[model samples]
Each structure stands twice: as structure tokens, then as C-alpha cells.
Target: MQYQAPVDDMMFLVKDVFSLTERLGDIADFADFDEDLYAAILEEAGKFATGVLQPINRSGDEEGCQYNDGVVTTPKGFKEAYQAYVEGGWQSITADPNYGGQGLPKALHVLIEEMFYSANTSFCLYGSLTGGATQLLQAHADEATKQKYLPNLISGQWSGSMCLTEAHAGSDLGLLKTKAEPNDDGSYSLEGSKIFITGGEHDMAENIIHLVLARLPDAPAGPKGISLFLVPKFMVNDDGSLGERNGIECGSIEHKMGIKASSTCVMNMDDAKGWLIGPPHQGLRCMFTMMNLERLSIGIQGIGLGEMAFQQADAYARDRLQGRANDGEAPAALIKHGDVQRMLNTMESFNKAGRALGVWLGSYLDETFHSKDQSKVKTADIMSAWLTPIAKAYFTDAGYETCTIGQQVFGGHGYVREWGMEQHVRDCRIAQIYEGTNGIQALDLIGRKLIGSKGEYLKVFLSEVNSDLVTMPDSAHKNQVSELLTELEQLSETIISRSASNSEIPQLVACDYLHYVALVTYSYLWLKMEVAAQGKLDQQSAFFFKRILTRTLGLKASIESEL
Candidate 1:
């Protein structure tokens, strides 16, 4: 299967659907970006994603990454593909201009990212994780560290990895056993092991920067004692050249279900020289900066794979002819069948809605980080805090569902290894599992986001949705969108009230609550998308009717019954 970047759809969402250029025109940082520049950047990125990286997606999945001794080798073409990514400056698209980056808007970055993920999920991780580390260093690392490390990562000269999980600790970072001992020269020496560390060791970049989580000897117990450390695989000399290999080593890489070309290593750190990035005993909070971004990236990854799978299935359905149509036409294409239409429609709906939501959130991130308006910035922060988990879980869940549907479109061929649909289904499954499981996301939604703040954040979000509803002209879709918002508010009240006494009610209903919220939010976007379309009818009505809005009643029943 050949992968083509859906630049038109993305451009539609960027220029027309979102009107991002007009919205950001007042922000000095973003004022210079025009449609022509956005198009040129997107065109080049599409070329790299489609022409360079995508060609190796299937081949890389088949060959996987090789591990010999402690060294990890990516698939044959991955290193070169990544090098091209660096040379083209794709890795630094949204990086700070002070550090060799183009300083582009993150919304544009998200669009380019989808192409990378859709074209090749495994190859995208090497840069994505590095970008996460670079973002963290830019935010918290001292001027010295920033000057030394940020440029390399921003330039893609060296890749970056975050080491947080240990054998004993997965989601619960407070229980991690990694130890960090303070040295005389104001650095820390970390000694412990980390598991499931993505890009922990790879042959693509010159050096690997590991942003690790460890506890100082005198540090208190639990998450409060945790501190983040900058541990590099190879130490840097005073002259900015590579020094001796550091204590960190890749013990082995896991044989995984998918994304095999990306290295997931068991990292052993023995007296690894590490420097503290943020304040002591604040590792978890510091990591959250990266964590929040990763959640969004992973969500985009989900949609990207979904988008890819949909393309493959659509192509296969249109080309592959088999049974007769219901109208007695012989040898009809699979696309003519109603069931096939349903499947394709469902996937397309997910892709459009998912892309819109991701870009919307990315725009908010731009506001949160760059905008001068304090009120807007505060609202963006809270909105991001509540929606991060939802975006993380909902997008991944949608991705997995869409991929499976695409696979099913192939019937027997989907089960076989003939096409790329099966691989997408497998690769997308991990998004929901890692970066905190979807279940964890649900827990966060109800426990922390809903219950912790006494529903103030949820109320703020509801008001935001309500504000959007006012501009939308009166129609069934608009009415339904309003009603769903109210119903969700009432349902949230029920969950909050019931959980006050039952305690287990939140857990029992968190997943459903998450889904209910996801449907409502997505429908809100569909309404805006409709407005963006000037109320014209198209395939989007298919998704709005069946996939999202129609589910409102059933969700109401489920949520109320749970309460």
C-alpha cells in the first residue's frame, strides 16, 4: 500500500475550518506566517513523509529493529530516513528560533506530525521523543544546559529519550526505585534500571539525551521526592565534542506487537552522570510538561494511523471487486455495498473529527504558551488540563476503532499479512495502553479533573461549549449539540453526587463518562465544522448523524443507569 499525505484535508482544516491565520495575526510570534508559507512547509513535509519515510513503513515493520549485545539497530532505511528528516528541518518545525529552530506554530507542527505518523509510526517516534525532551529542556533546564543540549536536539543532531518507568513502577511513578546520588561537582550520579524506554538507545543520532526520573538519597518518599535528571548516553567534552561513553547502556530491546522499528529498551544506568533539570522533589510536575505534550502527540499518532488505515481500506474497497450488488449488478466493487459504506463512513468521520479536535487543542496550546492575554492563557491551561486525558484516550480509542474497521473492510485479506491494514491495527493498539492507559485517563477525568476541583473545570468547559453554541444558527444539529451539553452537565452532576457516597461509582462509570464526554465534544466540533461549511451538506453529515449525535440518547441511558 502506498501512503499519500492528506494535505488538502489538513489545509482545509487549517485555512478554512479553523481560520488559524486570521486568529493568530495579532500574535507577534505568529504574525508573519501566511498561507503560502504554510503551504510550502506542508508540501515539503508531505514529500518527506510520503516519498521518504512511508516507503519503508511496511518493510520496517517486517524487518523490525535488531538487537545485538547492547547495541540497537533500526531497520535498514530508518537511519537514512531520519537523517533526511533532520536535513529537511522537519524535527525543528516548532522549536524555538533561538536554538536553530524555525519557530513555527504548533498547529502546523501537528499537521506535519500526522503525515509522519500516518506514513510511518515507528520512524516518527525517534524524532517525536527527542522533541519532547527538547521542549522540556527549553522550559526548565538552566541557561548552561539549554545552550549545550537544546541546539543539538532542536537540530536533530542527537535524539532524546525519557526514562520514567521501572520494573516495579509503571503508571505509579512514586513507587519507582531509581536512585540518584549527589556528586561533589554539583551533578548527580544515577544508578538504577528503566524499562520500556522508547528511543533509549538508537543508532540514528550522534548522541542520545536521556531525561530520567530518579530520587536523591536525602529526598523524601513518594512522588514528592522524585526529581528529573538529564543523563546522556555519551558525555560531552568542554569543546562540545563527544566524550567517553556514559554509564547508561541498553540491556535489550523488547520484541513488541508493532512499531518494531522503534527501540523500546531496558536501560541500565550505573553511576550515570545526571544533572537536575527542574527543582528537587518536583520530578513528576516537571515531567508533566513533557507528559502533556506526549499525550497529544500520541493522540495524533492514533489519528494518523487511523487515517492511514482508512486510506488503505478505501483504496482496497474501490479496487477490489467481488460479489454482486443488491441491485443485481455483477462483480460490483466493495465500495458499492452498504456495509462497506458504513465502515468507510465511520473511519472518515473519525479522521475528520479527530483532526479538527487535535488542531483545535494545538491552537489552544499556542495560546497557553505564547499568547500575552493572561485570561486566555489561564483558560487554555485549565481546558488543556481537563481535556488532555480525554484527547489522549478518546483519540487513541477512535484510532484503534477506525483501524479495526478499515481492516474489516478487507474481509479475509485484512486478517492475512497482504496489506498494511493489519499492521495499523496492531500499531495503534499501543497508543491507548502507553502514556497512561485509557483506563488511567478515565480515572484522571473523573477523579482529578471532575472530583478533585469540585467540577469547576468541567463547568468552565461547559460554558466554553455553550459560548460556541450561541453563534451556531438554530437547527437540529445545533439544538442537539446544546442538549448534549446540558445532558452531559447533568450526567456529570450525577456522577459527582453518586461518587460522593458510593466511592466506587467514579471507577465503575469513568470509562463511560469519558466516552460520553468525547461524543459531546466531538459533536460540538462537527457543529462548528458545519458552520465552517456554511451549512452545506456532505459526507460529514454521515458522521454527525450516525457516529456522534445519534449516540447521545444511548449514552444518556448508559450514564444515568450507571448513576
Candidate 2:
């Protein structure tokens, strides 16, 4: 199957739905963005993804990564793809220009990532993890750390990984037992192991940077005592040259169900030479900066895979001859059947809504942090926090389901390996499992974003949703969004009252509640897109409203019913 980047819709969301040309044009950094530059960037990104990455996707997966004598080698062509990626300056899209980046909008970077991820997820991990590390180091790392690491990472000379999960620790980082001891030179000795470390040890880069979480000997136990450190694979000399290998080493690469080409490893930090990024015993706070970005990136992985699945399924349905259409016309292919249309429609609705949500949220997030205006900053922050978990859990869940449904369109052929549809299914499955599993995302949504803030964040979200509906010109989706808003309001009250007596109520209802929030958020985005598209998207918008958006009513009943 061949992959084609959905450049049109991506451009539409950025230029139309978000009103980028108008809203962002006033911003000094985005003032000079022109049509030619925009087209060139997307065209080149799509070309690179298809020409460089897509060719190796299935081949790399079959080859997987190799582990020998504690050395890890990614599948054939993987390293070359990364080299092209860096040489093309793809990693600098959202980086600070001073550090050798183009400094494009992060949301725009998300659009570019969808293409790369859709083309080859394994090859794409190297770039995304490196960008995540850049964010961490820029935000929390000292000036010296930033200077030493940002340029190389931004230029993609080295890759990075987050080393938080130990054998005993998964979502509950507090249970981790990794220890960090103070050294005479103000560095620390980190001794323990981290598992499921993505691209933790790979041969593609000259160096590997690990953002590890460990605790001091006298620090308090659990999450509060944890500290974040930067443990590089090789020490750097005073003259910026590579020094001897550091204490970190890859024990072995994991044999995984999917994204097999990407090296997931068992990382051993045996008295690793490391430098602290932020204040001591305040690691969790700094880690969230990276973790939140990873969470959103994982969600986009789902959307990327969904797009790939949709393309493959849609193409196969049109070309593969099957039963005749029930409609009067003599149909030659399966796509003529109503069931086939229904399947495609389901995939299309969620993918469209999910992708739009991701891009818009990314745009809003950039504004939240970068805008000089105080009022815009405050508004964007609220929406960013509210949508972070939704983007993570909802998109991945929907993306996985989309891929499966797309596979169903192929019937038995979808199950066959040679068809390549099964690979998308396998590759997408891990998104829901990794990056703080979808279940934990639900808990984070309700327990942290909604309730932990004492309903402050939800109020902001509701206000914005209501504002969007009111401002949107009259349309079918507008009323549906209104209904969704009202349903969410009632559901929130139900959850609040129920949780008053039993705090565990969130755990019981978070899964359902998360779906409720996701459906509403997606519906709102559809309505917004429909309004912005000036009726071009009416069909897709209605498909979501009638087919999937109706689920919230049942969710409300589930949330309120005696359990």
C-alpha cells in the first residue's frame, strides 16, 4: 500500500479552522508566512516521508532492530532515513531558531509529524523523542546544559529518551527504586535500570541523551522525592568533543508486538555520570513538560496510523471487486455496499475530528506559552491543560479502532501480512498501551484536569465551547454541539455529586466519563470545522453528529445510574 499525506486537510485546519493566516499573521514570528513557503514545506515534508520513510516501513518492521553485545542497530535504511531527516532540517521546525531551528509553529510540526508517522512510525520516533528532550532541556535545564545539548539535539546529531519506568514502575513512578548518589564534582551516580525505553540505545546517533528519574539517599519516598537527570551515553569533553562511554548501557532490546523496528530497550544506569536538570527532588514537575508533549505525540501517532489505514482500506474497497450494490446501479466493487460506506464513514469521522483536535490544540498550546499578550496566554493555558489528556487517550483509542475498522473493510485479506494492513493494526495497538496507557489517561482527565483543579479547568473549557457554539453561524452541527455541551454539564454534576461521598467513584466512572468528554470535544471540533469550511465539511460533520456523537447520551445515563 502507498501512503499519501493528507496535506490539504492539514492545511485547511491550520489556515481555515484556526484562522492561522489572520490570527497568527499579527504575531511577529508568523507575519511573513506566505503561500509559497507553506506549500513548499508541506510538499517537501510529504515527499521526504513518502520517498525516504515509507519505503522502509514494512521492510524495517520485518527486519526489526538487532541487539548484540549490548549494541543496538535499527533495521536497514532506518539510520539513512534519520540522516536525511536531519540534513533536511526537519527536526528544527518547532525549535528555537537561535539553536539552529526554523522556529515554525509546533502545531505545524504536528501536521508534518502526521505524515512521517503515517509513513513510518519507527523511523519517526528518533525525531519526536529528540524534540521532546529539547523541550525538557530548554524549559528546565540550566543555560549551560541547554547550550551543550540543544544545538546537537536540534540538529539531530544525537537522539534522546525518557528513562522513568523501572521494572516495578509503570504509571506509578513513585514505586521506582532507582537511586542517585552525590559525587564530588557535583554530578550524581545513578544506579538502576529502566525498561520500555524507546530508542534508548541505537546506533543511528553519535550520542544518546537519557532524561532519567531517580531519588537521593536522604530524600522522601514516592513521587515527591524523585529528581530528573540527564544521563548521556557518552561523556563530553570540555572542548565539546565526545569523551569515553558513560555509565549507561543497553542491556537488551525488547521483543515487542509492534513498531518492531523501533528499539525499545532495557537501560541500565550503573553509576551513570549525570547532571540534574531542575531543582533537586522536583523531578516530576519538570518531567511533566516532556511527558505532556509525549502524551500528545502518542495521540498523533494514532491519527497518523488511522490516516494510513483509511487510505489503504479506501483504496482496496474501491479496487477489489465484491458483491453487487443493493442500490439500483450495477456496482462492481465493495465500496458500493451500504455496510462498506458505514465502515468508511466511521473511520473518516473520527480521523477527521481527531486530527483537527490535535492540530488546533497544538496551535492553542503555542499561543498559551509564546504569546506576549497576557489574556490570550491565560485562555490558551486553560484549554491546553483541558485537552492534553483528551488528545492523548481519545485520539489513540479512536485511532486504534479506526485502524481495526479499516482492516475489517478488507475482510480476510486484512489479516494477511503481505497486504500491509495488519502491520498498521499491530503498529497502532502499542500507542494505546504506551505513553501512559489510555486507562491512565482517563484517570488523568477526570482525576487531574477536571477534578484536581476544583472544576476550574472544566469551567474554562465549558465557557470556550459555549462561546464557539454561539459564535458559529447557524448549522446542523451547531445544535449538536450545544446538546453535547449540555450533556457534559449534567454529567459533570453527576460525577461531582457521586464523588462527594466516595472518592473512588472517579475510578469507577473515569473510563465512561473520558469517552463522554472525547465525544463532546470531537463534536465541537466538527462543528467548528463545519462552520469554518463554509459547508464544505457538512457531510463529514453530520456523520459524526448522527453516528458517533450520539453516544454521549448513553454515557450520561451510565455516569448517573446507581452502580
Candidate 3:
């Protein structure tokens, strides 16, 4: 199945829904970017996603990656595609201009990422990790490390990876046993094995820079003792030339159910040369910065996957003839059937909601990055933190469901590999499992986000929602939005109170709480989009906006049932 970039829909969100131009104008960091230039960039990105990278999606999945003696090679054509990606300047879209990045607002980057993910998620993982690594270095690493590494990484001459999980430890980073012993020359010898390290060892770039977490000698126990390190595959000279091979090596690669095109390797750091990122014993605190961005990125991936699946299924239903409709007409394409239309409509509504939410979250991140006012930055950060897990779990869970629905639309053909629907199902499954399991994500939402800090986060979040409700003019739809807000407040109260009384209550009710939060958030965005579409409701726009409102109502009904 071929992937097509949703350029028109994305442009609608960028220009109409979120007002990207206005937001960028307000940010001092992005003051240099005008809409025309941004559009040109986005156009190029869309072309790359549609015309270049997307065509190779199935081939990559089929060929997978090859692992040899301490070397991992990507699928055929990936190297050339990656070269085109580098030349197009995508790796640096969110990086700093001081280090040769385009320095575009990350909101734009998020939109581009969605298209890239839809086109080829497995290939994009390597670039995603590299960008995350760059963000870490720019934020915390010393001037020397930043100057030496940032340019190459930003330019895509080198790729990056995150090494956090071990066989014994996944979410519980405090249990990690990777040891980093200090050396005489202000370096550390990293000795440990890290598992599930994506792009840990790949031939896609000149050097692989690893942002790993390990425990330093003489440090306290648990997460407090852990620290971040930069362990490159090949050490570089002061002038950025390759110097010597680092001690880190890929022990082996994982054979996974999905994303086989991307190598998930076990990295054995046998006295690997390393430098600490930020303060000692504050690894978890610092790692959370990258992980938080990653969580939301993965969420966008889920939505993108779902959108891709929906597009394919919708096309197939239009082309494939099936049984007659209820009107007793002769057999027509399945899309002519009312029930099939209903399924497609649901998928479309879910996809739009997910996209709008992802864009909103990305705008929040841009605000967090560019806002000079500490209070504004804090507000955006809190809201982003509160919504990150929801975005991750909800979008991905919905993606998996959408993929299954797409398969169901295909009937028995979906179960077989010939239709390619099975691949979508398989690829969408890992989004929920990796990047922290969906169950754990839900627990984090209710347990940590809602009840954490004695409900301060949830309280502040509800205040913002109420503030929006007040500003919205009174209308029937407005009243409906207000009612949803009221229910959300009540739900929050019940969850927080119940969770306080019983430690297990949050876990028991996590799924319900996650659904409630997701529905409420999506409803808010759907309303905004509806209002935006009111004056300019062409057939396409009207159909899309109405379908979203319909889904919002359905999700609202679901939330009430849980109550």
C-alpha cells in the first residue's frame, strides 16, 4: 500500500485551527520565520514524505534489517532515502541555528513528523532519536560537548540513540545497574548492557551518539544515583574528525513483532568512554525531559499510523465490490453500505481529533520552549506534562483500534498478508507496548498526573478549561461544551477523592479516567474546529467538522457510562 501525505488537512490545521503564523510571530525565537518560507519548507517535507520516502515503506518492512559481527545494516534504499532526508534539512528542523539547524518552530516540526511517520515510521525512528539526543545536548551538555557534537548531529552526518531499558528494568529506571566509573581525565568508563536500544548500532550515519543512563561510582542508590552519559560509537577529534572506535558494541538485535526495519539492539558497553550530561545522580530528572518529548512524539506516531490505515481502507472499500445495501440494490462496493460508511466515518473522526490534539500539544511545547515569561512557560509545561501520557496512550490505543477496524472493513482479506492490512495492524501494535506500555501510561495519567501533588496539576488544568469555556460565547454548542466541562470537573473530583482514600483506586479506574480525559480534550478541539469551520463550511470541511462533533458526542456517552 502506498502512503499519501495529508498535505491539505495538515495545512488546514497549521493555518486555520492553530494559527501557526500568529504563534510564530509572537515567539522571539521564531520571529525570523514568515509563513511563505515555512510553507516552502512544509511543501518540501510533504513531497519527500509522499513522493520519495513513502514508496519504500513496504519494501523496508519486508527486507527488515541485517545484523552481522558487531554491525547492523538498514534495509535496501534506506541509506539513499536518509541521504535525501539529510540534504532536505529535516534533521535540523527543531535544532538551534547556532549549530546549523534551520531553527524552525517545533510546532512545524511536529506536523512534518506526523507525515513522515505516516509515510515510514520505521525509517523515521532513527531520525527521531537523533533529534531527541540533540535536544538533550543543547539543554544540558557543556559548551565543548555541544560545540563538538551538535553540528554533526544536527546536520544528520551522525545519528543518535537512547539507551535506558535493561532486561531486568524497563519503567523502573531506579533498578538500573549500568555502572559508570570515573576516570582520571574527567571521563567515565561505562560498563553495562542496555536492551531495546533503538538505532543503537546502525550503518545509517557516520557515527552513532548514544545518550545513555548509568549509575556513577560512589553515588547513592536508586534513581537518585543514576546519571546521563554521551557514548559515541566512534570518538571524534577536536576538529570533528573520526579518531578512535569507542568501547560500546552492539551485542545483538531484537526480533520484534513490528518495526522490523528499525534495529532494536542490545548494547554492551564494556568500559565505554562517556561524559555525564547535567548533574550527578539526577539522571531521571534530566531523562524525563527527553522522555516527555518522546512520549508525545510516539502519540503522534499512533495517530499517523491510524490515519494511514484509514486512508488505505477507505480507498479499498471504495474500489472493492461487496454485498448489496439494505435498500435491496444490486451488489456495490462496500463503501456504499451504510454500516461500512459508519465505520469509515468513525475512523476519520478519530484521526482528525488525534491530529488536532497533537497539533495543540505541539503548540504548547513551542510555547514552553520560546516563552520568555517564566509563568507562561510554567503553565505550558504543566499542561503539556498533564496531557503527554494521555496523548501517548489514547492516540496509540485508538490507532490500534482503527487499524483493526480497517481490517474488519476488509473482511477475510484483512487477515491475510496480500491485502497489507495485517501489516498496519502489526505496525500499530507496538506504539501501545513500547514507549511505556499503554497500561502504564494510563496509570501515570490517573496516579501521577491527576493525583500527584495533591491534585494541583488536575486543578490547574480544569481552571484553564473553565477559562476557555467562559470566553466561548453562549450558544447551543457552547452550552454543550460547558456541560462537558462540568462533567469533567466532577469526574476529576471523584477520581482524586477516590484515589486518595484507596491506593488501588487509581489503578482500578485508570482506563476510565484516561478515556474521560481524552474525550474531554478531543471534544474541546472539535468544538474549536467546528467554530472555525462555521463561516467557511464547504462540503469537505462541513463533513469533516460534523463527523468530529458526532464522535465527540459518542465519546461523551462512553464517559458517562463509566461514571
lDDT for model 3, on a 0 to 1 scale? 0.83
Which segments of model 1 are wrong by more than 4 Å? 535-537
lDDT tens digits, residues 1-563, model 2?
67888888888887778866666565667667765676679989999988999999999999999999999998889888888998999988888777787877777888888899999998888788888999888889888888888889989998899998988778899999999999999999999999999999998999999999999898798899999999999998777789999999999999988999999999998879999889999999999889888888999999999999999999999998876677665656888988998899999998999888888888777886568888888988888888988888888889999999999999999999978889999999999988898889899888988778777788889998787677778766677678778768767876776777889889988888999999988888888888888879888778888888878889878877743
Report the poorest 10 consecutive residues by lDDT, candidate 3: 536-545
Better structure of 1 and 3 per lDDT: 1
Clashes of each: 0, 0, 0
Error of 2 at 154 (Å): 0.4
Local error of candidate 2 at residue 260 (angstroms): 0.3
Q: Tell me the deviation in Å of residue 118 in model 3.
A: 0.8
lDDT of 3 by residue, 278-393 (tens): 99988778877788778888887888788888998999999998888777766788889988887887787678878888888887888887788788788888888888899999
Q: Rank the candidates by lDDT, best first.
A: 1, 2, 3
